[model samples]
Target: MPSHAPDRFDEVPGDLSRVGAHRAPRPRHHRVRAFAWAAL
Candidate 1:
Protein backbone atom coordinates (compact mmCIF):
# COMPACT_ATOMS: atom_id res chain seq x y z
CA MET A 1 0.00 0.00 0.00
CA PRO A 2 2.91 2.37 0.65
CA SER A 3 4.05 2.02 -2.93
CA HIS A 4 0.57 2.86 -4.10
CA ALA A 5 0.59 6.26 -2.42
CA PRO A 6 3.19 7.86 -4.66
CA ASP A 7 1.58 6.25 -7.67
CA ARG A 8 -1.68 7.87 -6.73
CA PHE A 9 0.08 11.21 -6.18
CA ASP A 10 1.44 11.01 -9.68
CA GLU A 11 -1.91 10.00 -11.09
CA VAL A 12 -4.01 12.54 -9.26
CA PRO A 13 -3.41 15.40 -11.69
CA GLY A 14 -4.22 13.31 -14.74
CA ASP A 15 -7.20 11.91 -12.94
CA LEU A 16 -8.34 15.40 -11.99
CA SER A 17 -8.50 16.30 -15.65
CA ARG A 18 -10.17 13.09 -16.77
CA VAL A 19 -12.62 13.30 -13.91
CA GLY A 20 -13.89 16.66 -15.26
CA ALA A 21 -14.74 20.01 -13.66
CA HIS A 22 -15.92 18.38 -10.47
CA ARG A 23 -12.41 17.09 -9.90
CA ALA A 24 -11.34 19.75 -7.41
CA PRO A 25 -12.92 18.35 -4.28
CA ARG A 26 -11.98 14.78 -4.88
CA PRO A 27 -8.33 15.56 -5.47
CA ARG A 28 -8.13 17.75 -2.40
CA HIS A 29 -9.77 15.08 -0.34
CA HIS A 30 -7.43 12.41 -1.60
CA ARG A 31 -4.40 14.67 -1.05
CA VAL A 32 -5.40 15.24 2.53
CA ARG A 33 -6.06 11.57 3.04
CA ALA A 34 -2.72 10.70 1.47
CA PHE A 35 -0.90 13.24 3.66
CA ALA A 36 -2.57 11.88 6.76
CA TRP A 37 -1.47 8.38 5.89
CA ALA A 38 2.03 9.55 5.05
CA ALA A 39 2.26 11.34 8.37
CA LEU A 40 1.52 8.06 10.11
Candidate 2:
Protein backbone atom coordinates (compact mmCIF):
# COMPACT_ATOMS: atom_id res chain seq x y z
CA MET A 1 0.00 0.00 0.00
CA PRO A 2 1.10 3.51 -0.68
CA SER A 3 -0.03 6.90 0.56
CA HIS A 4 -0.18 9.65 -2.04
CA ALA A 5 -0.51 12.15 0.79
CA PRO A 6 2.67 13.66 2.00
CA ASP A 7 3.87 13.76 5.62
CA ARG A 8 2.45 17.23 5.65
CA PHE A 9 -1.30 17.49 6.20
CA ASP A 10 -2.85 20.40 4.33
CA GLU A 11 -5.39 21.04 7.08
CA VAL A 12 -3.06 20.47 10.02
CA PRO A 13 0.16 21.66 8.56
CA GLY A 14 1.39 22.70 12.00
CA ASP A 15 0.72 19.31 13.62
CA LEU A 16 2.55 16.11 13.03
CA SER A 17 0.71 13.05 11.81
CA ARG A 18 -1.20 11.34 14.60
CA VAL A 19 -1.10 7.56 14.33
CA GLY A 20 -2.40 6.32 17.62
CA ALA A 21 -5.10 6.53 20.21
CA HIS A 22 -3.44 9.98 20.59
CA ARG A 23 -3.03 9.04 24.23
CA ALA A 24 -1.55 6.21 26.19
CA PRO A 25 -3.61 3.09 25.55
CA ARG A 26 -5.69 1.80 28.39
CA PRO A 27 -4.07 -0.89 30.48
CA ARG A 28 -4.56 -4.43 29.08
CA HIS A 29 -7.29 -3.20 26.76
CA HIS A 30 -5.93 -4.66 23.54
CA ARG A 31 -7.49 -8.12 24.06
CA VAL A 32 -10.89 -6.56 23.63
CA ARG A 33 -10.17 -3.27 21.97
CA ALA A 34 -8.14 -4.79 19.16
CA PHE A 35 -10.93 -7.14 18.11
CA ALA A 36 -13.49 -4.41 18.31
CA TRP A 37 -11.49 -1.90 16.34
CA ALA A 38 -10.19 -4.44 13.83
CA ALA A 39 -13.49 -6.31 13.52
CA LEU A 40 -11.67 -9.48 14.22
Candidate 3:
Protein backbone atom coordinates (compact mmCIF):
# COMPACT_ATOMS: atom_id res chain seq x y z
CA MET A 1 0.00 0.00 0.00
CA PRO A 2 1.10 3.61 -0.63
CA SER A 3 0.69 6.71 1.57
CA HIS A 4 -2.06 9.13 0.56
CA ALA A 5 -2.94 12.70 1.61
CA PRO A 6 -6.36 13.22 3.24
CA ASP A 7 -8.91 15.60 1.79
CA ARG A 8 -8.90 19.17 3.24
CA PHE A 9 -11.79 20.47 5.32
CA ASP A 10 -11.24 23.98 3.87
CA GLU A 11 -12.91 22.82 0.63
CA VAL A 12 -16.29 23.12 2.39
CA PRO A 13 -18.17 26.45 2.36
CA GLY A 14 -17.88 28.80 5.37
CA ASP A 15 -21.65 28.68 5.86
CA LEU A 16 -22.33 25.33 7.52
CA SER A 17 -26.08 25.61 6.97
CA ARG A 18 -25.52 25.22 3.24
CA VAL A 19 -23.84 21.82 3.64
CA GLY A 20 -25.36 20.26 6.77
CA ALA A 21 -28.59 20.23 8.81
CA HIS A 22 -28.84 23.44 10.84
CA ARG A 23 -29.66 23.59 14.54
CA ALA A 24 -33.00 24.96 15.70
CA PRO A 25 -33.13 28.42 17.25
CA ARG A 26 -33.25 28.64 21.04
CA PRO A 27 -33.53 31.28 23.74
CA ARG A 28 -30.16 32.53 25.05
CA HIS A 29 -30.74 32.92 28.77
CA HIS A 30 -27.08 33.70 29.46
CA ARG A 31 -26.95 36.67 27.14
CA VAL A 32 -30.14 38.07 28.64
CA ARG A 33 -28.69 37.81 32.14
CA ALA A 34 -25.41 39.41 31.01
CA PHE A 35 -27.25 42.34 29.47
CA ALA A 36 -29.32 42.76 32.60
CA TRP A 37 -26.19 42.85 34.76
CA ALA A 38 -24.47 45.27 32.41
CA ALA A 39 -27.42 47.59 32.65
CA LEU A 40 -27.03 47.74 36.44
Candidate 4:
Protein backbone atom coordinates (compact mmCIF):
# COMPACT_ATOMS: atom_id res chain seq x y z
CA MET A 1 0.00 0.00 0.00
CA PRO A 2 1.17 3.50 -0.78
CA SER A 3 1.23 6.19 1.95
CA HIS A 4 0.63 9.89 1.38
CA ALA A 5 2.83 12.45 3.18
CA PRO A 6 2.97 16.23 2.84
CA ASP A 7 6.25 17.84 1.74
CA ARG A 8 8.07 19.67 4.57
CA PHE A 9 10.17 21.91 2.30
CA ASP A 10 7.03 23.39 0.70
CA GLU A 11 5.54 24.21 4.10
CA VAL A 12 8.66 25.71 5.68
CA PRO A 13 8.99 28.74 3.38
CA GLY A 14 5.41 29.96 4.02
CA ASP A 15 5.77 29.50 7.77
CA LEU A 16 9.08 31.38 7.87
CA SER A 17 7.71 34.27 5.73
CA ARG A 18 4.80 34.76 8.13
CA VAL A 19 6.97 34.78 11.26
CA GLY A 20 9.70 36.95 9.69
CA ALA A 21 7.34 39.95 9.48
CA HIS A 22 6.87 40.15 13.25
CA ARG A 23 9.41 41.57 15.70
CA ALA A 24 9.74 39.76 19.03
CA PRO A 25 9.26 41.81 22.19
CA ARG A 26 11.46 41.30 25.24
CA PRO A 27 11.63 43.04 28.62
CA ARG A 28 14.82 44.83 29.70
CA HIS A 29 15.21 42.69 32.81
CA HIS A 30 14.75 39.52 30.80
CA ARG A 31 17.46 40.60 28.37
CA VAL A 32 19.85 41.30 31.24
CA ARG A 33 19.12 37.90 32.78
CA ALA A 34 19.70 36.13 29.48
CA PHE A 35 23.08 37.81 29.02
CA ALA A 36 24.08 36.95 32.60
CA TRP A 37 23.14 33.31 32.07
CA ALA A 38 25.15 33.12 28.84
CA ALA A 39 28.22 34.57 30.56
CA LEU A 40 28.27 31.78 33.15
> Which model scores highest in lDDT?
3
Residues 2-40, candidate 1, lDDT per residue (tens digit)?
Answer: 554365444556534456346555445788899899999
Error of 3 at 1 (Å): 39
**Clash count for each candidate, listed in order shown:** 0, 0, 0, 0
Report how far off residue 40 is in candidate 2 (Å).
8.1
TM-score for each model: 0.32, 0.26, 0.31, 0.31
lDDT of 1 at 1: 38
- TM-score of candidate 4 to 2 decimals: 0.31
Write one digit per residue (lDDT tens) for candidate 4, span 1-40. Answer: 9977878543445433345435344556988899999999
Residue ranges of candidate 4 with Cα displaced over 4 Å: 1-28
Alpha-carbon lDDT, every model: 0.61, 0.56, 0.63, 0.61
Candidate 2 least-lDDT 10 residues: 8-17
TM-score sort, best first: 1, 4, 3, 2
lDDT winner between candidates 1 and 3:
3
> Candidate 2, clashing residue pairs?
none
lDDT of 2 at 28: 88
- For candidate 3, write residues 1-40 as lDDT tens digits: 9977768643666554544443333457968998999999
Model 4 lDDT on a 0 to 1 scale: 0.61
